[model samples]
Target: MATLPKPAAISIRTVGPFDLGRLSRLHKSCFEEAWSRSDLAHLLAMPGGFGLIARLYEGGLVAGFDAMRGVGFSLCRVVRDESELLSIGVAPTWRRRGVATSLLQASMERCRAIGAAQMFLEVAVDNHGAQRLYEEHGFERVGVRPDYYHRPNGERVAAYTMRCDLEARCGPSRGP
Candidate 1:
């Protein structure tokens, strides 16, 4: 049998203000309606808002363009005992490689560590893959929003509202 190459190492870090540009670029690469730097800044500036960035590091190269590349990101916010996942995306080339899973898991852990008892998210009704992922992670569809997403071509799409009990799935909050 041919020997298979090992998977590259992926590291995730909390997004800082200085990383807005990189986050914007990665969002653009992953979504057609990417959030602008100003928009990301606004989101991060909100109270209880937080973001995470995932980087894929290949081999020993650690100081150049190809050494570390942004592959995915998740934006979330906690208000009192509830949290919402604002957005999440993974680069096309890195899809199906566990990047999104890692981001989601990290986001959940972060929210649970704070004081969030549950997490909510919206996904386009047609996005079955994302719905499956959310379901696998203890989320369940609670409701639906009519015409929630507007496309560039002027079409509106519906979305499903999903919720996950953080306290049940991740135990209780550790601390602030």
Candidate 2:
């Protein structure tokens, strides 16, 4: 018999080179325009690209799995600096439990630690729920990328280029 990787503990851990499966699923769950398993797997293989997941805890089952789901899909040449929130998605059953908040917090902390100056994310222009959440978390709309999202109505939806200063937004929370 082959030994298996231990099931994820119910806590935040670095979404290291491993754990791409859960991360990919979380992306599809959160975004109308989802990424493929292979697409995410390729990103993981590159350097300087970050991803994180939130796993639910039960006796032994991992419920409510989630990921930071960074939006940009890079095939190669991962740079240390750039702004892009590739994606963030939580299992539908896990909605309204602050999972998205926790995921964002974790991702920001990690980004700050790694010396990222700004983070960019494209939210559906009409997605008030997510926009409010992002605003409360310090993200501001810098511009709009028109025809940026694939709408379910088969129309192209606009997306906002929201940017948050990693250090300025996260440092104060640590202390004076």
Largest TM-score belongs to which candidate? 1
Worst 10 residues of 1 by lDDT: 1-10
Residue 63, candidate 2: alpha-carbon lDDT = 30
State, as a TM-score between 0 and 1, how close model 2 is to the true structure.
Answer: 0.74
Candidate 2 CA-lDDT value: 0.64
TM match of model 1 to true structure = 0.92
State the lDDT of candidate 2 residue by residue for 1-176, as single tens digits.
55434333335655655666666666776666677777887766667666666665544344344333222111212246544666666666566556667778777766666666677788888988889878988999999999998677899989988988877887733311
| TM-scores of all candidate predictions against the true structure | 0.92, 0.74
Candidate 2 at residue 78, lDDT?
Answer: 20
* C-alpha lDDT values of all predictions: 0.90, 0.64
